[model samples]
Target: MSPEQRLASLLAMHGENELVEFKEAKNQYAFDKLGKYFSALSNEANLCGQSRAWLVLGVKDDRTVVGTQFRTKTADLMSLKKEIADKVTHRLTFIAIHEVAHPQGRVLLFEIPAAPQGLPIAWDGHYFGRDGESLGALNIEEIERIRLQNRADDWSAVTLPEASLEDLDPEAIEQARKSFARKNPRLIAELEAWDTPTFLNKAKLTINGKITRTAILLLGLPEAAHWLNPSSATISWILKDRDGLERDYQHFSCPLLLSVDEVFHKIRNLKYRYLVEGTLFPEEVEQYDPYIIREALNNAIAHQDYTLGGKISLVEFEDDRLCFSNEGGFIPGSIESVIHADAPETRYRNRFLADAMVNLNMIDTIGSGIRKMFQIQRNRFFPLPEYRLNERRVQVTIIGRVLDQAYARKLAACPELSLDDIMLLDRVQKQQPITDQQARHLKKRGLIEGRKPNYYISAELAEQSGDKAEYIRYRAFDDQHYKQMIIECLEKFKTARRSDIDRLLLDKLPDVLDANQKHHKVKNLMQSLKNQGLIENDGRIWRLSNP
Candidate 1:
């Protein structure tokens, strides 16, 4: 069938839905907005189990072929693919751009390939998906569904026949032996008795002494990295000034077993001092916990998608934050899920790499590493680790210094609170979103106030945190207090304009409200006084009922 015929059939049968989007670029359409539609439509196609989705230009919402003048030139239209490819993850471009000459005018059908299984397509580092006709940020559930589509493939297990012991760094192999010995303390004598090949085989770095990608990634010589083809075991450490300019940089290749330390040492990690607050004395500790540093670096290596040919990045900021990023989407779907998972993740992108790392005492398979990072930060009264995940990469930011000392002190004092509770309250302090289930849990504990996604620490938390003044601002005055103010104003003036009542209560309303919300709230308060017969309004002026 002709392309236009197929589009007509789809419109007649399916109309506008998750898999089909119609746009009337009568004159033109936004480039950025079009990119967002690409991400959303592609993700929706994956969820719907379709091979492709349609972005039909020159069509209005009424299914009329109104025609689009957008990028009518053949070359101009062709350049859009490269423009989009530059910004999107994986450089996913259109499968085909068909310009159909309809009876009305020129109609373009851009065939968008469905997001690849296990990788949701991202536009400009953000995931988008459709909810029927609406386009918005892809929800967590949908993102996870797309990511878990194919979980069985393990790329690190692929064996490289040409690689040998000579290609492996001798020092890294010895370091691995020591790490293995530490992990298997009971097998020290036996471990020493085993030859290097035996140790490599037993350590799962190779498949029956056949060097696998995991071996080359962890213990291979720096030059041996080329054996992995496009993939490289390269870790880049960048030191950035407060203004975000690169001040110093270094890259470590292969023997990731030893390079992890080199990257760690490059970080400033200066001694951080918790300032005196209330009765608590100042205490000093390393800005970054040693465990956090190793766990983050090791996790990045273990979870990195070496197939992407991208170097693992460790960006150290002078502003007391460090960001570690690797080429791969977070497999657990969300960091919160990992931090709260009751059981370990059942799948890994690099199962062989993970198993080998476990044998080398590099990481645990139980998935408690991420959770422990959070606890360590909470115990130190620092902001919890922040994770930024997208289809292209998993980035984690660790803050070294205290952002809210009173809040930290209050949390430190609360020995009865569980780690989960402290984490939620920490989210509130950070102004991050919490799940509805989490919101209810915190509300049940009376630890937060206000609405979903906008919750503030409750008076209990604020009062205990030594910030009652701020809490009062968020808590606002009682309705009766505002009502009495209205009554006093009316009695004084015999009558008052709605603006006067608004002026009295707008500033006094909870700071949680936006300007529009504050104004709406004042209107509601005046309405209540009128309903209570304490005052009346002539749709313009309000006065005491008796007056």
Candidate 2:
């Protein structure tokens, strides 16, 4: 069938749905907005399990062909594909753009490929998806559904009969032997007595005495990567400076078991020393914890969706943070569940690979790794590990040092607080919003005080911890302070404009209030003074009543 007829048939059958977007670009359309639509429609197609999405230009919202004059030149239209690929995540672009001249008007049909499984398409680092007919941020629940789709299938479990023990790297195998022996000290002699293949089988890297994709990815020679075909077995370590500029980068391919240590060694984990209030000597600790780094890298390896052909990424910033990302969402839904649950993830994207790592002493599968990361940060009085998960990927960020010494000292002073409470307080210190339920709990415990969108640390606790000035900075000031400031300003200037009053009082107002709130506060104080015959504003300027 002709492309026009096929599109017409699709429109008649499907109308406008999640996978089909009709835009009446009558004269023209912005290129950037077009990119966003591509991201939205492509991700929608993935969620709907469709092969492709259609961006039908010259079509009205009601399915009428309005005829668009968008990018008349053929070359200009064709160049859009490359333009979009340049800015989008992973270089995903349109599959085809068909210009069909209909009887009434010309229709421009752009076919967008469905988002790859376990990897949502993003435009300029922002993910977009359809919410019925409205386009916005992909719903978290829908994101989770797309992420959970691969939980039942294990990419690492697929056996490759063509692959032989010869494909494995000898050095990697030796390293794996020592790691496995260390993990199972009681069977050290027995494990050392076995041959390489026997040891690989025991380590769960082999399937039914045969090498699998997991084995190739973890221990195979770099040249043996062809056995995995389209999928890559590369870990990219990137070092970025404080200004977000790339300082250096190194890619580790195959022999991932040994590459973990190599990547760790490349990072400049310098010693961080901080002086205690009472201690004579400063305490020294490594900026990045060794266990934290290995666990993060191992988690990335275990959860990466190899079918997507994306490489694991480890990004380090000179400002003291490490970010590890893998191309699959967190399996257990939320980080809170992982931090609080007694059990490991119920399902894994790469179960066989995770099992092998667990056996090889790379990571623990009992769910203690993530919680331990949080606890270790807490013990050091540093910010907890952050897990940023969406449909496309999971990124874990480990902060190395204290961001705010006052906040850290406050947390250290309060040892009775639970980890959950500490996490919420950390959010407050970072100025991140929390849910109303969390606010209520914090208020009930005297941990926080004030109204919505303007909460501050409890005044009593702030005073006790020597943070009273910070508390006053964030909390609303008493009415007397506002009145006095205005009276003093008007008295000094003899006549003051509202803007002048704003300049005098705005900064003195609570840090929690936005500009509009501060304006209202000043206006109300002036009105109250006027009512008592102390001050009055004539059109633009205010003056003392007696003056």
Candidate 3:
């Protein structure tokens, strides 16, 4: 219905409902308060299984239209959509702000869309909902109920009405055929007899000879990208210098079947050379395993949320590391589950895209994809893949070279340690914190020791690896050791400055503590000695206790 007809229909209602809110903003409305109502109504719409909610300005809570002069100009009023989008979750805003000239006066009807599936809408980090016409915080149960609506409808499984075989690139289709034949080698001779449309159907890239978004993304010509409209199929490859400056960049649009190779070749996979502790000759290997680059890129393409209209990004930093980022939170939730699970994850952000890629030999959901990435890096003595997952994006960084050449070979020596166990130990070595539960699990294996945020490889593992000295650097010393040293230094030096005390014990502190933390540690230690009447201080200087 037209905006005028819809407004009249809503006006005839007995009172305001969960999907509609009426406001008499005679002169102005608070932007923040407006945002809260937007969040509340949007969330309520999702919960009620409705597509949209309305916020009618110039209309009172009693359904009386008194007219509003809020942003009377058209451009000024429409800009509110962007204003709301900037602060709301996922940048989702109004479908349209409808203006209606009613018999009462001029009314502004603000259209708000429903929250995206599985993700709740929040205004300034707070969720709001309606309690029988009263606005309040969305309760935990309601919030979870909204969040649990995870992608109920699969966008990738949809077929585009305007797309056909003519839109597909010839070269990309040929590559797809080669990949599919290779994946199903038993059908090689039979595949030669199949036609283009017939082959695409068999490969699951189309439905009943109709092109799917997956087909357009993987094999469709560049011009066919328009069929996906608001969602583009683009992969961006960027190269950066050691200083994190972008030196070169390229954006590859459909057909992505061939662009994957182009993007891979653009990455400078130089040879990484490192020497083992006991060896004179430097061991050499390719900076990135070929499978790693392909798997990571394909995984990004397979899991990317195309509805966001963002490009999959692969950044190569001076040939040392490759960081691949896609626009979507991880479907499997955590990298831990993917690494530790014996089976593959059936959940995917783009199920149809991932399945087609598997048929095209671009990706595999089996353990060979993610789990093998870790094992390959482990076998090469490199750090395990790093996953940075959050609400809107998933980024994975692959370190191309060994961090500690000495400990790397030794880490390999821990054959009894599972890949998952070593993965957590790798975090400890990098000074990354593990949960208390994780620490306890590792401690039970005698593979780690010390406290949270300062855990170190255990003494037994250190002895086995013959890196006891390195272990001591990570291990923190007792406070008594530091206190006695300070007392002894004061006795010999008469009056030592704060710097002198720092010099005495700063290097003796745990390597994990940064400069500021080490200074804080010294401050605490000096305060402890003073409280015990073990030392006398003259402001900047300290002397031995005077009884």
Candidate 4:
């Protein structure tokens, strides 16, 4: 059978189960419900070890093909991709939206890819799982099951009995010793007294003096990689120009303890200078935070799925953004939880490796590192790190440089704003959409102006910050200004068409409004004028009431 026939057959064969959901969206369907089902079906598919899940919109619970008139327009139908991506974890969206024309009626098939093995897909910050034929919070047991997938037989903790301490790099071991000493200042003398094998054991890099995969990753010589055969232990740093052409690239192998430093040194930490409004001097800072860079790199190394045989990547862009990615799903369910709670992760992808890194002072076990990255950027008035977690890997982007000078100045002016509030305002500056809850919070504080999806810094904020121009730009003139414009248009032409009135006022309206909304704004202005006896609209034409 053909692909479409195959899909139809599958839908006919299955009822609402963990991997399939049936909805009779004859005329319209709730978009929010679609997002929830996407989350539920994706998680359910992962739990059942399925490659994909089905969401049939035109099908009823009893498996009847009623057809759907939902989002009939191609553009509107396709826009669901972005709408769903905005709120889903890892930006997960439908893999494909298929329309099947059957002998009985039409059918809409939403093909959703399964969630990553270890990461549960969440819609609007809530994980959904299928409970029989209904949807509910992913059961604690299921959540734990997903988390355990990442904890599977940590390759880094596996012992390589034949490998000896001789396979380790002496320089790497010395560096490890210093890091461990710094981490344990009180035990410095004791740490120094131990030999290589003893120190490795004490540092948890070895299993009772027996070489392990973690030992080879952090302290193994380049040639020792053979001991871990098949599992690759390497980090590749690649630089790309504006055109995406490779400008420079280098790979660092085993002995990651020192190679991490080598990778850091290769990056061009240029000085970024931004003008501080109301001051003659410009504030200068590094493109990227040194601590953030190290933390991200070490986190990648500590959490990397070594058994996957994929190399970690550090990709640098000419636009001053650095991306660090490793082969594994994020151990923490979400980055927001880590940032807001600032609590230690309850589990780790590579527990032994993470413990060793913590002992060496490479990463913080308290889970403050990611939060620190956000705080550092907030203090600098730069964008926070962007995290993209997927089934195959966890990627983070550290944006450097001030994206908007006005935004930075506003931050400086408003010292009382919390980091969370600043983050929302930062999204506003970047033209990214904020959640309704966030919009209401910002609106309640009089910190934002205009309708959502186009909210900008409010005039109140601008006035407080001495940004008179921005205040005027974001806050369009009041009813009087629009009223005056309508009167002027009528005066210029004895009678005006509704289209003419729109032409006079639409462009002058707030940029936040769409074309249809702008048209309504013009009609509302005409009605207000008519109510005041200043103008009258005789169906198609508008004119001064007296005229």
Enumerate clash totals for all models, in the order shown: 0, 0, 1, 0
The C-alpha local distance difference test score for the whole of candidate 1 amounts to 0.84
Each model's Cα RMSD: 15.3, 15.7, 16.5, 11.0
Better of 3 and 4 by TM-score: 3
Runs of candidate 1 exceeding 4 Å displacement:
1-153, 275-280, 435-437, 451-453, 478-547
* Cα lDDT tens digits for candidate 2, 200-257: 8889999778999999988999999999989989999999999999999999998999
Residue-level error in angstroms, candidate 1, position 158: 1.9
Evaluated with TM-score, which candidate comes out highest?
3
> By descending TM-score, how would the candidates be arranged?
3, 2, 4, 1
Q: Can you give the lDDT of residue 180 in candidate 3? A: 97
lDDT of each: 0.84, 0.83, 0.84, 0.83
Q: Any idea what lDDT model 4 has?
A: 0.83
Instruction: Give candidate 1's error at residue 283 in angstroms.
Output: 1.4
Reference-based TM-score of each model: 0.63, 0.69, 0.70, 0.66
The candidate scoring highest on lDDT is: 3
Write model 3 residue lDDT over 1-547, tens digit each, in one string.
Answer: 7778888988899998889999999889898999999999999998999878999999998888899988886546756766787787666677767777788888988878777667788998999999878889999999999767665777777999877889999999999999999899999999999999999999999989989989999998998999998997999998899999999999999999999999988988888888755679988999999999999999888888989999999999984889999998876556754554435554567777888998998886564588888889888889889999997999999999987653585675676676757888889867787765466667877888887677778888888878888888877888898998998888788898899999989999988688998999999999999999999788897898863
Q: Candidate 2: which stretches are off by over 4 Å?
A: 1-152, 277-280, 497-503, 513-541
Tens digits of per-residue lDDT for model 1, 1-547: 5676877786685468998899989889999998999999989998998878999989988789888899876557756767887787766767657777788988888888788778898999999999889999999999999888767668899998878889999999999999999999999999989999999999999998899999999999998988888886889999999999999999999889999989888989899877545656778999999999999999999989988988898999999998999999886556644554434555678889999999999998676898999889988889999888998899999999998665686776566887767877878788777765467667777788888656877888776667788787778667789888888888788988888877777888877677988888888887787788888767797778887
Q: After superposition, how far is residue 68 of candidate 3 from its true place, in Å?
A: 65
As for TM-score, the candidate ahead, 1 or 4, is 4
lDDT of 3: 0.84
